[model samples]
Target: MSAPTISYENHRFPPQVIAHAVWLYFRFPLSLRLVEEMLLERGIVVSYETIRRWGRKFGAAYAKQLRRKRPSREDIWHLDEVVVSIGGRNHWLWRAVDKDGDVLDEIVQVRRDTKAAKRLLIRLLKKQGLAPKRIVTDKLRSYGAAKRDVMPAVEHRSHKGLNNRAENSLCRCENENE
Candidate 1:
């Protein structure tokens, strides 16, 4: 199914200006006021609350379009898991990244067993519509176990040093959350 078209009716600013403001706010880590200031520098006198409203109205559609524009799947995938504490409870964050260090998929689950790993693999494979030539991960036996059942023909490289890309991606995400 296709995404619904965004309506730009009943707005003072042109569609281009509104779209640019929304893009600036979501495509970067800048705050709403920062986005407002940047737009003001361009002589577009708009309120931060207006920008926030546009983001709330159009953010998901913009993100959906970006996801639809993903390039071809990489040949190698790096899979990793990390434990995170939330509300005094522990949850496992399973992530899959391509060779270029771009996150392909992620899932948060309570368990980090073979079943969880398999779920990640299945979701990745379904989303990508193709299995990578190989997958690298830490010395996690669950990954190996899941790989056998999900994509047995794909190569599995289990090494601590080989999966720094995935580890670093997780680190960056955690840092952003803090």
Candidate 2:
């Protein structure tokens, strides 16, 4: 059979160039400017603004694609919340991750009460399509109500030091925001 036809008529650069540009933005926490500077040193002449746009357009898609191809979850789910400041207002960010540290979902809310916890659970349920076999959370009363309401049958456990995984995840986000 003849070789497959190649199509580079409309694009300015090859697929490998675009993929590398997108990979630099997603695989690291670096800003677009940093990525641009790194590429500039390597003789690439792309702009930071272009990199920013590529990230916004392709980051979520790439993340979703990678997640879909990953192995099945095998660890207990961990849930936690942290205080965040957005638009000069204090907010709470609730997050859930699988046992191997894959972020399932996150929600930013005004409070960490029962309603917020329930919303977080709902969001995760909608994304993951099933409740975790076991849920581990801190000794927050709101979590108790949320667990009962959203995942009645899942084992809910609260113990000191058991929620370190979730707490560390939140801590990482906090540090990145600073």
Query: How close is every model to the real structure, measured as TM-score?
Result: 0.66, 0.63
User: Candidate 1 lDDT, tens digit per residue, 29-105?
Assistant: 99999999999999999999999999999888888877744535357999999998988999998999988788999
What is the TM-score (0 to 1) of candidate 1? 0.66
Clashes of each: 0, 0
Residue range 1-178, candidate 2, lDDT tens digits: 6434333356565666666788988898888888899889988888988887667766666665565533333447888888889999999988897786767788889998999999888888777776777889988889889889988988888875898888888777669899
Backbone clashes in candidate 1 total: 0
Model 2 deviation from native, Cα RMSD in Å: 8.1
Worst 10 residues of 1 by lDDT: 66-75
